[model samples]
Target: MDIRFIPQAEIDKQLYNSCVHFATNGSLYGYDWYLNATAKEWDLLVEGDNYVSAMPLPRTTNWIGRTQLTQPVLVPDLAVYSVKPLSPKRIQAFWDAVPEEYRGGGLTVEPASVPKNAGRFEVTTAVGDALFLNKSYEEITDDFPSTYYEQLARAERADLLPVPALKPEAYADFWLSVHGKSVDNEWKYHAMQRLMYQVLHRSWGNAAGIQTRDGQLLAVSFNVYSHNRIFPLFRAESKAGGDAGAMTLLNDTLLRSHANRSLKIASEALYQRSR
Candidate 1:
């Protein structure tokens, strides 16, 4: 139950890598190769002989002399990554091990591994979506709302075909055109999102794209995979793609292609609006 906050440089990379490498709930977000690009500093948590968890804390200072730790963009949930699925007691123990200052700034972790009723900190939840391959691809297709099918068919008719992969920069350009150009906030996170592309480019994942007949990019899909799960980290579509459901068709195409892998898409964010 003892936790030590060893600085990233001082931490043993081999042991830490092994911790996440063998973690039951591991994702690319927990890996150094991926996290290092976005986070400057992180602390490893150790329980006796084992490196149990790692926390990447990206801190910033304001002109008003206020400094605070914030979760880096492209990293959704990276609190304490444990080797085992976090139980209530383990989650509490892990937090108790974390220093109080580090605790207050709020951290996010995967919904599946989250600790319920954490002590004294106000908690919030965001609903997400995933698709599992327990059923045949055809059966899974049946589960898609009639609208998904309708839009997908329309996209196909318009010749928005799914290709196995696309360039990260191409995807970013399209993403910015759709989200950043249209939104008032201007999606300041696009920089971080693009950095994620470089990180993931070296990792075990695949990118898919939907394009017009002349090869104009419509939508891009970047999904990272663990042993048996796929995390649909980010997917974006242009207005034309959105109008024709290019993204939906792309996702379905991905599922159908990978259906033989017995993979489950563990998404906390569902693709479509729920009625």
Candidate 2:
């Protein structure tokens, strides 16, 4: 068996086409888009003749964070791999080949059975989502106290915060500091950043940072966009003070702006773990 690394962008159309054909008839979620989005950060492993596999490598440093709640490990799309049916031994061997540094991180494996002309092909898909927030804004805000709205109104009247906008480059150091807090894992940082980028680029999402009256960053929140539905992916507050209420205020303001629409708020899984 020989293992070859191919840039994700260079993968032949036939391979993707094949995957799509199988995906259409398979139970996999987001299969078609997954196959199409495979990029240079992904790899394909081939055995003697019939078996094939696709693996995704860590492509960014957003997953790592000092605080468990702040980490980006749960964003559903980090490192993943898709493979045609192979024996347990081959599967184990394939994982064994991964560099030790990358092997022990947030790697996940999912297996699917796809029927091929020759016979049956087992497709193993692996990825990780440390936290997934897909609920509407109302669902998200339900967790906070009712007084939160009053505080948000105050903040807005005082002009004490910046509007949440997509500021990818502005938060570089903030992201790095969060990543540095991790004890052993570094791959998480990449996942975190990817999640942030995905949210920022989506027309349905917006991100903003909150600062204290003294101009210190108090928290950051990613608000989902929708006419009648809203979701909050990541919402965090600085550890320097007991201003947890600030986050609640941020959410209140967001909800008020979209009060005309039905809203659901969701948070990363890590948020619950941290609390």
Candidate 3:
């Protein structure tokens, strides 16, 4: 029950990372490498000597030059992951461990680890769809609308193909080319590219895309494989690709390949909630 804030330099990475690696509610977002790529600076909040419960506190200096605790870009929310479902008191203790200056920052707890009551915490629930890949491909596809099949057929007719493990640089450039206007700042643009390279080069995740017969890129996604789940970091589809159903085809191909694996694809709703 002893909870303390450990600065980044002071953290015992071996113990802290092991806790995050094995936590039932873990995700790539909690990993040190991930925080290193996205956070301006960060530290840990650990529950005990064994590091049974933990959270990563990411910090940043705002545009006005004020330091603030914040979540990383492209990350929807974070959690106080633990060995077991923590009681409200334990959860509160973790919150109480936050340095007073960082108190106002918010974090979202994993659905599995959240308690029924949160003492003194303003708890709110955000729900999103997840594609559960427990069933056979056919069984899962049976629930899809007829239009999905039609899109797949269109993609097929257009000779668009799903290509796994897309090259990082190519995909990043394409992503920025297609969506750069939407990204308002140079920092965010660089952060997105840095995250893509880190996730792909480190083998923590992969980039998949759809391409034409001539290998022209059309649609792409960066999927982080962690916590026994697939979370998309960035996804985009060109108009030509969308019209040809390249994105739909790419998604179906991914689902089919992983069908019956008991994995979940974190939905677009989940990934884009913070955006």
lDDT of 1 by residue, 208-247 (tens): 7888888888878777777477776566788888887788
Q: What value of lDDT does candidate 1 attain over all alpha carbons?
A: 0.64
Tens-place lDDT per residue, model 2, 1-275, is 46554444665646643443343122121222332332213334433333245433333233562111110133333212234544555555554444433323333234322112211112334432322234455665566554665655545654556544446444534544544655333443444455456545655566767765667666666655432334454455655312344565554555556544443332122222111
Off by over 4 Å in 3: 61-67, 112-126, 182-185, 267-275
Choose 1 or 2, whichever is better by TM-score: 1
Give the true-structure RMSD of model 1: 3.4
**Could you give candidate 3's per-residue lDDT for residues 1-275 as a string of tens digits?**
78888999988888887888898767777777667767758888998888898978787766766655675776676678788666777766776677866644454545644545544444444357877889899987776777888888888899887774567667767777777556354455667678877776767778889999888889988888877788877688888888898888878878788999978876432322111
**Model 1, residue 220: C-alpha shift (Å):** 0.9
Clashes of each: 7, 40, 0
Best by lDDT: 3
Show the lowest summed lDDT stretch of 10 residues, model 1.
266-275
Clashing residue pairs in candidate 1, if any? 77-108, 128-268, 128-269, 128-270, 129-268, 129-269, 129-270
Per-candidate TM equals: 0.82, 0.43, 0.86
- Supply the global lDDT for candidate 2: 0.42
Better of 1 and 2 by lDDT: 1
